[model samples]
Target chain A: MAETRTRGRAPTDPPASFVWTRRIVLTLLAVFTLVPVYAMVSSSLKPLEDVQGKFRWIPSEPTIRPYIDMWSTVPLARYFVNSVIVAGGATLASVVIAIGAAYAVSRYRFAGRRVFTVTVLSTQMFPGILFLLPLFLIFVNVGNATGLALYGSRGALILTYLTFSLPFSIWMLAGYFESIPRELDEAARVDGCGPVGALLRVIVPASLPGIVAVTVYAFMTAWGEVLFASVMTNDQTRTLAIGLQGYSTQHEVYWNQVMAASLVVSIPVVAGFLLLQRFLVAGLTAGSVK
Target chain B: MTSAKVSAAGAARAEGAAAAHGAGPGGSTGGRRRRRLPGKALPYLLLAPAVAAELIVHVVPIAVGIWMSFKELTLFYIREWSKAPGKGLGNYRVAVDVDGAIGADLLRSFLVTLAVTVLAVGLSWLLGTTAAVLMQERFRGRGPLRAIFLVPYALPVYTAVMTWAFMFQRDNGMVNHVLADQLHVTGGDRPFWLIGNNSFWALVTVIVWRSWPFAFLVLMAGLQNISRDLYEASALDGAGVWRQIRHITLPALRPINQVLVLVLFLWTFNDFNTPFVLFGKAAPAGGDLISVHIYHASFVTWNFGTGSAMSVLLLLFLLLVTAAYLLVTSRRRPAHG
Candidate 1:
C-alpha cells in the first residue's frame, strides 16, 4: 500500500501544510494522556498540603515525605512481599503447566483433542465473580476439613489466582506452539532424540518468546487483581491489590496514600509491559484471535 | 563446542557399530516397533494440572454455588459443627423475591451494575472507536501520541479511583473547582459528589475515562489490520468517508467489536474497586453495584448463604446476557451457510 501510494506522490502522505497542525494535535494528545500519570507521580512526591486542589503541574517543593509516611503508617512492604509471592508463584506454575498442555494439544493428534481445546476456550466465558463465594466456601471448608487453614492465607490467594491465569496461559501457549513447525521436532527425533527430549531441547527453546509473554500476562493479572485477593486473604496475607483497599476507612478514604501506593504498585507492571511489549503484543494479538 | 566434539566421537563409534552390525545381522533376533498411539494418555498427563486447577478453583465453585443456592447456611451455623441444612428454593427465594433488606439490596445492586455496564461500555465504545479511526491517520508525533493514550490503562485502578475521589472532593476538588470557576456551575454550595445520586454518575465517568483506552487499543489494532486497498478503492469510487467506513471498515470490525463489547460489559458489571473506595460503607446507601453488595454480604454482614445466592444469580444473569449476545451475533453472520 505504501509503495503504491508513493508511486506518483511525494514521500509525505499528507500535504506539507498540515505538518504543524499534526504536531499541535500530537502534543495536545500526549499531554492529555500524560497528565493523570504526571499528577500521580508528582502527588506521590508532594506533601499533603501540596496535593490540595490548587496544586500546580509541578510541585513547588518536591518531597518524598509521603513515601516515608506511608511506609511507617501502612504495611506497604508486607503487601509488596505478598503480591510478589502470589504473582511469582502463580506465573511460574501456570507457565510450566501451560507449556506442557499447550505442546500436547498443538502437536499430538489425540482423541478428544477438539473437545479439550473447546473446553479450554469455553472456560473463558464463565463469570469470574460467581466463583468467588463458592471458592471462598471451598477454601473455608478445606481449611477446616484438612486442618491446613487455607482461608485468609497466601496459599489460598495463590491457588485462587491460578484459576484465572491457567485458562489464558493454556490458550495463548497453545497458539504459540501450534505456530511452530512440527518438522523441527521430527528432525530432532530422527537425530536420536525422543519426544520428551525433542520437546525440551527444541520446542521449548523455540517458544521462549510466547512463554515470556504468558509469564508477564500472568504476573500482571495476578498482581493487579483485587477480587479473589480481597476475598481470600486478610490484612496479614493481603496483597498490594487488597492492601490498596485500606485507603478507605468505614467513613472516609485517604486518596493521597492510595494514589501513592497505586503508583508504587504499578511501577513493575508498566516497566514489564514496556520492556517486553514487542513480544507481548505479538503473542497476545497472534494468539487471541484467528 | 564441547557437545560437537562428543558428537564427533559418538558418530565414529556409531559408524563402526553400523558396519559390524550389518555383517552380523543374519544371526540377530527380529523384533518390530509398533506405532505409538496418539491417545496414549500422554495428553491427559500434561493437561492434568490446568484441568485439575480449573476444576477445583472454577468448576467446583460453580457446582458448589449451585448447591448452595438450594440450601441455607451461615457463618454462625457453620462454626457450630453443623451441616448446611437443606432448604430447597429458600435461599433463592430470599435472594430474588424478599422485600425487606436482602432482596431490595440485591435488586438495587443488579440495577446499578446494569447501568454502569451500559454507560461504561456504550460510552467507551463510542469514544474509543472514534479515537482509533481518527488516530489511525498519518500524523507527526503519532507514535508518542499513541503511547500517551495508554496512560489511563497503565495507571493502577486503586490510584485512578483515588484520584477520582480527590477530583470529586466537595470543596477543593479540581473537577468541582473547574466547574465553578470556568463553567460557573455547582451542584450546590458545597457539593458532596459521593453523597447522593451524583456519586453514581461520578463513578461512571471515572470508569469510562479509565476504561476507554482498553477499547481504544483493541479498536486501533483492529483498524490497523484493515487493508488500505479497500479504503482506497471505496474512496476512488467517490464514496464519502462515512460511506467508506460504513461499507468497508464496519463489516471487517464487527467480530472484534462484538467480542470487546461483551467482555467489557461483563468486566464493568463485576468491577468492585471504584465503588468500594469512593463510597465505603456509604456504597449501599448511595447505590452499591452487585459486586460491592456481594462483598458486603459475605464480609461485612457475614451472610455467606445470601452472598453465595447473590453470586449465583449474578452468574445466571451473565450467562443469559452472554447467551443473548451469542444468539444475536450468530444471527448477524451473512445469511448463506
Candidate 2:
C-alpha cells in the first residue's frame, strides 16, 4: 500500500544506461521463475521417447500421446472426482464451523477462552502424520464395529484433510474477526437482532475477504495434500496426488503421462489462485500477522 | 457508550429482579433467569460445533494415535476383529534404534529432513531479506516484481511440482539442457540431475525454489513494516548499508525470522510431495526420506504396524529437533509473550 508514493525512480537516481541493465537483470530473475514451469509444459507435450531421449529445447517430434495416454491409461478422472468431492466438502464444512467459532472467540470473553485459544494454537504444532497410526486404528475399529470400514475409504481421507484445514481456518478467521469493529456487531444487536442474526447480517458479510482466503487455503491443502491422501485412501478411492504416484510401476515409469496428469490436477488450484491473487496475498499476510 | 448502555440495561434488569425478591417471594424467577442464561449461553452454543469438530477430528485422532503408539497396532489384525497384541516399546525399539533391520533409512530420513529444513530456511532468509531490501527501494516495477515473485507460492502443488520435475529430469531435462547448451559446460550432452547422489541436491533445489517465495512474502512484509526514517537517520550518521542491516533490520525482524525458520523447518521436515513427486516412486534406491519411507512401509508392504511405528519415531525426532531449536533460540533471547 505504501508503494504508491515510490512508483518511479527519480531522474537524479542513477545513470540512464543502467536502466536497461536493471531491466535485463529483472527479466533474468523472472525467467528463473518461469523456466521450470515451461519445461513441465514442454515435457508433458512430448512423447515418452522424446522425453527420455537426447536433450532438445523443443521436442523433436512433439505429440499429444502423453495427454491422450494420461486419461486412457490412468484412473485420473476418478481421482479428480474424488479430490473434488473430498476437498470441496471439507472446505465448506470447515469454513462454516470456523466462521461460527471465530465470531464467538473474537466477539466475546468467557471462561476457558484462553484455554480454547491455546489449544487451537497448539494443534498446529503436531505434524498430521503423527496421527496416521492412531487414526488408522480408530478407523479400522469403527469399520469393524459398524460394518462400514472407513480405512482406505473416501470418508477417511475427508476426515484426515480436516485436521489441517479446520485448525488453520479457525486461527485465521479469529484474527480477521477480531479486527472488525465491535461497534458494528453492537449496532446490529441494538437493531433488534440476536447474536446469530447479527453475525449473519453483519459480521459474515463484512469479513468476506478473510473467509475467502481461509476457503482457498483449506481447498488447496485438501486438494493438493499428498501425505494424508496417499496414506488414508488406496487404489479404489485414490486422489490425484496418489494417482500421480501410480504413473510409475515396477518396470517402466511413464514420465510424460505423469507430468500430464500432474498438470491436469494442478490447473484448477493455479487458476483459482490467479483469479483471487489480490485477495490471496492480502488474506495470507493478515492471517500470518496479528 | 454501547457497552455502557448494555451493561446499564443489564444492571437495571438485575436490580429490578433483586427488588422484586426484596419486595416479596411472589414474582416468578424462572422466566427472568432463563433470559439471562440464554443471553450468556448463545455465544458458547455457536462455538460448540467448532469445538466438537476439533475434538472429534483432531484431538481424538491424536489421542488414539498416541495410545496406539504405545501399543503394537495393526490394521490387518484389527480387520480380523482380534484384540491388539500389546507390544510395549517394541515398535519404538525397532523404529528408533533401527535394530539392524531395514538398514538406516529412518536415521537417514531424519538427517535429510533436518538438512533440508536448515538449508531451505537459511537460504530463503538470506535471499528473501536481500530481495525485500532491494524491493523496498524507490525503484520502478517494484510492485510487479513483488506480485510475480509470489507465483510459486500461489502455484498448486501438482503444477509447480510437474514443472520442477520437468526441469530436473535426468535426461533431456530443461535445466541440464540449458547447462549443456547455452552454458556450454557439457559439450551438448545432457547432464543427469536426478540420479545417484545428485537426487539429494535436486530435491533440495526444487524444495528451495518452490518454498523461498513463501519466505520472500513474509520477509518483504516484515521489511516494509520497518520505518524508513531509521534507515535515513542511520545513513546520515555514517552507518554503512551492511552495518545498518545488522543493527536495524536484523534485530527488528528477529521475531518473524524465528517464526519463519520454525515454520519452514516443520513444514519441510513433514513435506512429502516435493521429494516424492520430483523423484517419482522408489527414490533412487538410497534417497528415501522419512515421509517417503512411511509411504513405502504402509502402502508398499501393506504393513500398517511398521508404518505406525515409523510415524511415531518420526514424530519423536521432529519433537526433539523442534525442542532443541526452541531451547537454543529461546536461550539467545528471553521468551516473547
Candidate 3:
C-alpha cells in the first residue's frame, strides 16, 4: 500500500482534485470525533469553578488539583482495583476459553457445531436488561441454596460479565481462527504435536494479532460495563462504571474531578489500545493474507 | 529453530511407535483413527467449557427470565420469587394492552427507541463507511486522524457519556457555547439539552459518537479483504469514485454490513447505559429508551412480573426481527457464518 501510494499515478488512481476532498472530509470527521474527547480532557485539567462556568477552549487557570482531589472524592483507588480485577479476570478467562472453542469451530466439524455456533450468535440478540432481573434472582437463589456469597461480590461481577464477553469472544476468535490456514497447524500435528501442542506452537504464533484483537475487545467491553455493575455491586465491590457516580452528591457535583478520574481511568485502556492497535487492525483484516 | 525441528522429527517417530503399540490397548481409538473421523471427540472437548459457560450465563438466565415472566412477582414477593403466584401471562396481557397506561408508556418508549436506533445506526454506518473509504487512501496525517476517530470507542462508556453530559450542560457546556455564544445559532438562549425534547438528540449524538468508530473499525477491516484489482478494473472502465464505491465497495462489503447493521441495531436498541447515565433517575419522555423504561418498570417500581413479561416480549420481538433479517438477507446472498 505504501508502494502503491508512492508509485506513479495512473488512470486507476483517483483524480488529483479528490485529494483535497479527502483531506477536508478527514479533517471534518476528525474534529467531529474529537469534540467529546476535548471536553473530557479540558474539563479534567480545570478546577471545579472553571468547569461550572462557561466552556473554555483553553483553561483560564489550569491546575492538577482535580487529579489530586478525585481520589479522595470517590475512593477512586478501590474502584479502580475492583474494575481491574473483575474486567481482567473476565478478559483472561474469556480469551483462553475462546481460543480453544474458536480453534475447534474453525478447524474440526463436530456433531453439534451448528447448534453451538447458532446458540452463541443468537445470544448476542438478548439484551442484558431483559435478563438483568432474572439473573439477579438466579444469583440470589444460588446464594440462598448453596451458601455462596454472590451479591456485592467481585467474583459475581466477573461471572456476570462473562455472559457479555464470551459469546463475542467465541464468535470473533472463531472468525480469526477461520482466516488462518489449516495447513500450518496440520504441519505441527504431523511434526509430533498434539492438538493443544499445535495450537500453542503454530496457531498461536500465527494468529497473535487476531488474539490480541480479541483480548483487547473483551477487556474493553468488560471495562466499560455499567448496567450489571450498578445492580450486582455494593459500595465495597463497586467498579469504576458505577463508582464514578460518587462524583455527584445531593447538593454538589465535582465535574472537574469526575473528568479527571475519567481520564485517569481511560489512559491505560487507551494506551493499551493505541499500542496494540496495529496488531488489532492486522487481526481484523487478516483474512486475505494467504 | 533448527534443533527444535530436528528433535521434533525424532520425537514424531518415537510417538508414532508408541501410538501403534498403545492403539491395541486403546481399542476404541483405532476405528475412529482408521476412518479419519476429523477429531470428533477433540472438537467437543475444546468446546465444552465455553458451551457450558454460555449455558449457565446466557441460556439459563433466559429460561429463568421466561419463568419469571409468568409469575405475578412484585415487591412483596421478590424474596420468594420462585413461590410467587402464577399469573399465567397476565403480565404479558398488561404489557400488550396499548391503550392501558403501562402498555402505552411502553409503546411510546419502544417508538422512541426505534427512532433513535434508525437514525443513529443509519448515520453511524454512513459516517463510518465514508471515513473508512477515505482512510483507505494513504495520505499525510492519516495515521493520527485514524487514531483520533477511535478515541471515543476506546474511552470507557461511563466516562464518555459523562463527558457528554457535561458538554450538554445547559448553562456552561461546550455544546451551548458553540451553538449559542460562539455561533449565535440558538438566539443566545442556552436551551436545556438534558431535559425536554432536545434530550433525544443529545442521546443520539452521544450514541453516534461512541458507536460510529466501531462501525468504522469493522468496516475498515472488511474493506481490506476487497481485492484492489476490482477497484482498478472498475476505474479502468471509467467508473468514478462514487460509482466505484457503490458498485464495488458497498457490494463487496455486503457480508460485513449485514452482520454489522444487525449488531449495531442490537447495541443501539438495547443500550441502557447511554440513557441511564445521561439522564439521571428517569429519561425524559422524549428520550425514554425502552431498556431504561423496562429497568424502571422492574427494579424501580419493584414490579418484577411486569418487567420480566415486557422483557420476554422484547426478546421475542428481537428474535423475530433477527430471524426475519437473516432470512431476508440470506435469501439475497448466502449467510457467511
Candidate 4:
C-alpha cells in the first residue's frame, strides 16, 4: 500500500521541532476526540451530587450503580433486544437479497445493466425525509385494506430501513465482487461447476471481507437509526435509539443513567469496528478508488 | 445433493457450448453460443428481488410523496390518504410564500440548514484533511493515534450525540463547568448551550466532532493512493511541503475531495438525528434545521400536505445541486484523467 511505502521512505520527515509539533497536535486532537467520551463514562459512574456539584476530571467516588440501575430504569433490555432483532433481521435479509443482484451486475453483461447500476447509485440521492410520509401512509393503507397489522410493528421498521440499506449493500457488494478476478469463475466452470456453484464456492469466499463490511454497514444503519424507528415503532417494538429518548422528557432528564445506557448501547458497534477495521476500510474505499 | 444438480447443469451447458461451436463459424460462434445459453435469463432473475424491493419501498413512496404534496392531507384524512382533497399548488404556495406563517418558518429553517451544512462541511473537511496529511509522516504511536481518531466515527451516532447532549447541559454539563468555572473564560453562570440562540453553535460543535472522522478516513485513503514518488521528486527539486501539497497532493486528491464533499453536504443537509436528539421535535428558534422543521410541520402539527410540499421543495433543490456538482466534476475529470 502507498501508506506503507511512504512510511518506509520517510520522505515527508521534518526537523525535531516539527516532529514535536506534530506529536503535540496529534495528542491535542486525540484529547479533543476523547473528552466527551470520558465525560460520558465518568459521569455515568459519578453520583448525582458530584455530577451537579464541582466537575472533576475523574469521579471522586465511582460506582456502577447507574449501570446496574439502567437495566431496570426504562425498558433498556427490551430496547436492546428489539434493536438486535430489527438490525439483525434487516442485515441478514438485505445481504441475502443484495448478493444475488451484486453478483449478477458484477459478472454479467445484459440489457438494462447500465441502467440498473445507475438506478442503484441514484437511490442514495433521495433524502430519507421524503419517504417518511408516503411510507407511513402506505403502511396504514395496507394494514387497513389487508388486515396485515403492519403499522406499529418491527416489520415496518425493518422494511423502511431497506430503502436506504439495500442500495448501499448492493453497491458495496458489487464493488467487492468486481475485485474478484473473472478467471476464478472460469476455473470453477472448467471443474464442472455451474454459475451458482462458481458464485457460492469461489466468489463468496474470496469476497468475505467485503461481505463482512456490507453486513456491518447494514447492521449499524439499522441499529442507530432514529427517524423512522421513532415514528414506526410503538412502546413494545421500540429500538435502542428510540428507547434512549425515554431518559429525557419535558420535565426532567436523567443524566447519569442516560450516560450508562449510552455506553452500553455503543459497545457492540465500537467493538465490531475495532475487530474488523481492515476489512471495513478496504470495502468502504473499494468503489471510490476504481 | 446440490453439487450433483449443479454438475449436471454444468455438463448440459458444456454440451451446448460444444454443439454451438460445431454448428457455427469460429469467430462468431462464441457470441452465438452465449446467446443460445439456457441460463440467459438468470441475471434478470437474480436482480428481480432487489429491484422489486427498491421500487416498492423507495420509488413508489417518492412518487406517492410528490402526489401527496398536492393534496390536503391532515390528521382527519390520514386514515384514508388517497381520498384526501387535492389542493393543487395551494400547499406549495403556503410553503414558499415568505409573508405567511408556515412559509416564513420554512424559509428560516431552510436558511439555517444552508448555514449549518456549509459550516459543518467546510470545517470538518479542513480538520480531517489537515489531520490526514499530518499523519502521513512516520511518527511514533501512529497506529494508536489512528485508532483513537476513528473512535468518534466508529461509536454509535446516538451514543456520541447523547454524550454531547449531556456535556452541553447548562447546570451539570462539563462544557460550562470547564469554560466558565475552571478556565474563567466567562462568568460563573453557565450559558444555556441546548436552548435559545446558543443552540446553533452547540449543534454545529457536536456535528463537526461526529462527522470529521469520516472526512479523515476518506482523505487518509485518498492519501494512501497517491504515489510517494511525486513527493520525493518535488523535494529533490527543492519544493517545500506546502508547495508539494499544493501542486501534487491536492491535484491527486481532487476526485476524492469532490465526492467526499458532496456526500458530506448531502448527509449534513438532510440530517435529522443531530438536531432531533439535541433539540426535540420542535427545534429551538436558533437551530430549526429543515428536517425537524418539516417533521414539526407534518407530525407535530399534523399538516401532511404542507410538510410534503416543503419536503418536495427540498428534494428538488438537492437534486439540482447534485446534478450541477456531478456535471462540473465530470467536466473536470477528463483534464485530470
What Cα-based lDDT does every candidate model obtain?
0.68, 0.66, 0.79, 0.78
Please tell me which predicted candidate would have the highest TM-score against the true structure: 4
lDDT of 3 by residue, A94-148 (tens): 8888889988866764567666766665665678887689888888878877888
lDDT of 2 by residue, A36-88 (tens): 76666777887878777655668778888898888767787898888898888
Error of 4 at A37 (Å): 0.8
* Span of 10 residues, lowest total lDDT, candidate 1 chain A: A1-10
lDDT tens digits, residues B1-337, model 1? 1111111212222222233434554212224432343447778888888788878887778888777766666766554324778777777788888576778878887887788779888988887776776566754445566666766765556656677777777765666666766566764455668778787788788777777777777777677677777767766677655566578877877766766787677667777766766676448454477788788887787766777778878877877987898679858876421
The residue-level lDDT of candidate 4 at B141 comes to 72
Task: Show the colliding residue pairs in model 4.
Answer: none
Candidate 4 lDDT, B230-335, residue by residue in tens: 8788888987776776899788877777777887788888888889888878889778888889988999888889888988999999989988987898687874
The alpha-carbon lDDT assigned to residue B13 of candidate 1 equals: 24
Worst 10 residues of 1 chain B by lDDT: B1-10
- State every prediction's TM-score relative to the real structure: 0.86, 0.83, 0.89, 0.91
Shift in Å, residue B191, candidate 1 = 1.8
Docking class of 3: acceptable
Candidate 1 has an lDDT of 0.68
Q: Candidates ranked by DockQ, best first?
A: 4, 3, 2, 1
Give the CA lDDT, 0 to 100, for residue A117 in model 1.
56
Residue pairs with clashing backbones, model 3? none
lDDT for model 2: 0.66
TM-score of chain B of 2: 0.80
Off by over 4 Å in 2: A1-29, A47-49, A60-69, A249-257, A284-289, B1-38, B74-76, B80-82, B180-195, B235-246, B334-337
